[model samples]
Target: TNLEKRELVELSTRGLSRKEKLIVILYYLEELTMKEIGLVLDLSESRVCQIHHRILFRLKETLERMREDLLG
Candidate 1:
C-alpha cells in the first residue's frame, strides 16, 4: 500500500499536468476537499472530481506496469 502510494506520488508529480499536479497535492498532501480544491483552482467541483479520477487511473496503470516489469 505504501509502495503504491509512493509510486503514485512519484508518477503523478512527474507525469501529470500542472493543474493535475496541484489538484493531487491539494487533495492528498494538503488534505483539501474537492470543493476546496475547486475553489482554489477556480474550477467546478465536478471538474475537480474528473481530474482526480483520471489522475488515479493513470497512476494505477503506471504502477501496474512497473510491477509487471519488476516481476518479469
Candidate 2:
C-alpha cells in the first residue's frame, strides 16, 4: 500500500500539464470539490469532472502497467 501510494505520488505529477497537476493537488491534497476546483481554475464544472475522470483513468492505466512490469 505504501508502495502504491508512493508510486501514485510519483506518477500523478510526472509529465502532467500545469492544469492537470493543479487539479490533482486541489482534489487530492486540498480536498476540493469538483465545483470548487472548477471555480478556482476558471473551468466549467462539467469540464472539471471530465478532467478528473481522465486523470483517474490515466493513473489506473499507468499503475497497472507498472505492476505488470514489476511482476513480469
Candidate 3:
C-alpha cells in the first residue's frame, strides 16, 4: 500500500516506553491539545510541550531508521 501504515505500527510496537507511548497516542491519535494533555497528566503546558517534542523527535529518528531498513 502507498499509505505506509506499517511504519507507524512498528514504531508504536518497538520504539516507545509506556509513558512516552501514551503521550504520543493522546496527542496524535486522540487529537488532544497540549494544554489538555497537561491537565490530564497534571503538568504544565510548557512541560507537556517539552515532553511531546522529545517524544516526537525520538519517534522521528526511529521511523527514519525503519525507512532506511526498508529502502536499503
Best by TM-score: 1
Evaluated with lDDT, which candidate comes out highest?
Answer: 1
Model 2 TM-score relative to the real fold: 0.82
- The residue pairs found clashing in candidate 2 are none
The 10-residue segment of model 3 with minimum total lDDT is: 1-10
RMSD of model 3 against the true structure: 4.0
For candidate 3, list the clashing residue pairs, or say none: none
Order the candidate numbers by TM-score, best to worst: 1, 2, 3
- Summed over model 3, clashes come to 0
Q: Each model's number of backbone clashes? A: 0, 0, 0
What is the alpha-carbon lDDT for the whole of candidate 2? 0.86
lDDT per residue (tens digit) for residues 1-72 in model 3: 423544664456465676667677677667799899888888898998988788768878877998999999
- Model 1 TM-score, all chains together: 0.83
* RMSD per model, one decimal: 3.5, 3.3, 4.0
- What are the lDDT scores of the predictions, listed in order? 0.88, 0.86, 0.75
Q: What's the residue-level lDDT of 28 in candidate 1?
A: 82
Off by over 4 Å in 3: 1-13
Regions of candidate 2 where Cα sits further than 4 Å from its true position = 1-11
